[model samples]
Target: MPERSSGRRPAALVIGGGMTGMLAAAVLSDHADVTVVESDVLPRLPAPRKGLPQARHAHLLWSGGVRALENLLPGITDRLVTRGARRVPIMSGMVSKAPSGQWFRRFDDARHLNLVCSRDLLDSTIRTEVLRLPRVTLRERTELIALEGDADRVTGVRVRGSVGDGVLSAALVIDATGRASRAPVWLTDLGLPPVEERVVDAGVGYASRFYRAPASTGEDFPIVNVQADPRRPPGRGGIILPVEEGRWLVTLSGTRGGRPSRDNGEFVPFARSLAHPVIGDLLAGAEPISDVVTTHSTANKRRYFEKSPRWPAGFAVLGDAVAGYNPVYGHGLTAAAQSVLALKRVLAGHALDSPETARHIQRRAARPVGQAWDLAVGQDVLYPGATDETPGRLERVAAGFIDRAVDAGARNPHALRVLLDVMSMERPPARLLAPDMLFRVFLGRKEPLLDGPPLTEAERKAAGL
Candidate 1:
């Protein structure tokens, strides 16, 4: 490892204090002094911050992400559960309506699960863990103005205080400022060419609200989802996630003309009108806790910085800054966690000042980003008015294979395990393309497809339906 000047600890400056930035700071703190700069005042508790409006919506920490986060911050999952996040076992703990039909009976042997909770709680828990590191300091109410070095290398960032224009410098800089980052322009100011970018907008919109869980069910309710079928002409979906505080976070979404409404009165009816009305039925018995919140920023965007021939040393981008996916896929947080894990791996074997550390880290992180981007954009492109990026022959073949796998999985336990593994991010998508999986796909649905939500009589009575 290259030693810092006079054997002193190197310093790293992180722009943005969101989950990704906080995780980055935590990982970097082990090897250097880290400071996190945030443009908004962070809430001391698991509450909403000004910058993350999406916090009002539901978010899931898939099992793969949970494992990565635990690796980064041990015992964080237990802490999150203690605070209200539910550990929902995959397939078994979910009631899903798929395009092929209802999901089959999930076996107990499933290895993955999803962490269901509000985005605020998830971010706050991560923020708390990162701040507990003694070597990490936070400078809230500060914004990055520009990079402090040239095209060959970035020495630091020029940040203006939220109250004033005071600036600070460090040895390395990380841009985790999210989808709205200005790093491309900052690099251009240093005479670098524009970074390559790709955008696949689905014209997707979201409307969500909080509802107090039904008294009969208490706390520990399973997540219910009515998924959209992209094979259909129009795309629409809904999900009801059991969150902390004995509440359910319900989100309804649509693409193009099928968009859900922001009107509170229309929420239930809109949900009922979805391909499956289970979500609407479940919400009928719950008490509303919040008004409908709506947003329309579900674009799958990627900035190809690693492919840029001349990336500056001592600088890197992570999380939404590198790629922002369609939120409907619920891959944003997981992708961020995966990126942070990649950063830690790269730093463990290389020095921050090494000639190729940043480039190598970016390349490794790109793997997860590419996986998520492909999944999101591939489906989004099929929706009418979603994008003009025509699906090539390869994309169509992949989609057909996935569709077959999903149909098979809905009835075959072996096939379900493969689908669950990929959905949880525990394994790569290629796992579904394995020879065994392909054979299962050929066999197709072994049992009759379910016609509706497979709810037990007890659950039906509890929901007052």
Candidate 2:
């Protein structure tokens, strides 16, 4: 650990100003003065930033993440809801067709809820909440040049701001940069071994657009999703999220050959071509609010920073820098929130200046990251050209059982409860393999599966179906 001036409070540098970075700053503010460095000038309102290209797509914050956010910034959820974000109950608030091709019953479960809103709103709210802390500051339009330390310990970060280049010395440096982080190169530049990494890309692509919600749908309109079936090559899916201001943030996605196109004329057709046409049918009567935005950066990439034998003492990485998953699973946001909570927990037990603190934080962050990784790749690996390495026997076995679980969940409320728990990231995937859960999957009584989406009469009428 590097020493500051005698009796001077230690300073922390957070590189990135997105959700994960904001949460990290909030937590670190308790122990040190924190400076958040961001390349883009952040918006005061719930508007998009250039750094977050995925903001145009729908984003879900699972109950696990909701709890984490509340823990980090108390009353933030209320603030979000007041600003038009929704707290939607999991199964009850969603009308979804599983990847295995079964429509889930809208079983009510208060325990599993998701925060639904535009990514811009969520980020803006969190950024506002974090910045209000007395000890935290934000440096916008600043570029991170390099880390200023040796392989053993990180002293601070070198940055080039509008004012010109300068070094910001700190006792701790946390990296919260997303999928495009340069941390791996930064680490290697400081004389460490290359971090082990794995990328499972189904060659997924996304095309998203906004639409005005139908007049007949009320404030509690449910999320409608049609998930892709990995067993089918070039799997296609779509979701209609009723976000704030009575608008729908609709996103359509597909693997490799089946990806959606950017042509405005093709957007609705693409949704109609999904495993189900419910999204398209609903959008047929709505008015477009935004042009179609497409992105192809939907790969599940993970860097094994925790496994590196020689981690620097004063530096740690969080969020998508640790792992970025396919957007369809909706676990990236949850995993990042949980990882920040892990950082909070580890910091409670370790001294900030200790050499082992960064290593400990890095390892703790990996637990949540790994959990989300397994869930995403469990299906992604089944795609034909996702990765060169074939699914191991264990992965295959897990997938078979998961398929059985999903089948049971679609028809049985009890099974669905357990499934939602795991899917929402409230519990580890191991919960699905419990003896009782296995019994429920194999022999539990179930309602007959529906032949089509179980849309309520009012919902069907609302879409003029």
In candidate 1, what are the lDDT values of residues 235-283, reduced to their tens digit?
A: 7899988888888899999888888888999999999989878898889
Q: List the residue pairs that clash in candidate 2.
A: none
**Relative to the unseen true structure, what is the C-alpha lDDT of residue 383 in candidate 2, on a scale of 0 to 100?**
95
Instruction: Write down the worst ten-residue block by lDDT for model 2.
Output: 1-10
Best by TM-score: 2
What are the per-residue Cα lDDT tens digits for candidate 2 across 1-465?
332334667899999999999999999998899999999999999998799999999899999999999998999999999999999988788999999998998886787879999999999999988999999999999999899999999999999998788999998999998998999999999999999999999999999999999888878889999999999978999999999999999999999999999999999989988888889989989999899999999999999999998999999999999999999999999999999999898888876767898999999999989999999999999999999998889988889999899999998888998998888888998899898888989998888888888888988887788
Give the Å shift of residue 142 in candidate 2: 0.7
Alpha-carbon TM-score of each model against the true structure: 0.96, 0.98
Which regions of candidate 1 deviate over 4 angstroms? 1-6
C-alpha lDDT of all candidate models, in order: 0.85, 0.92
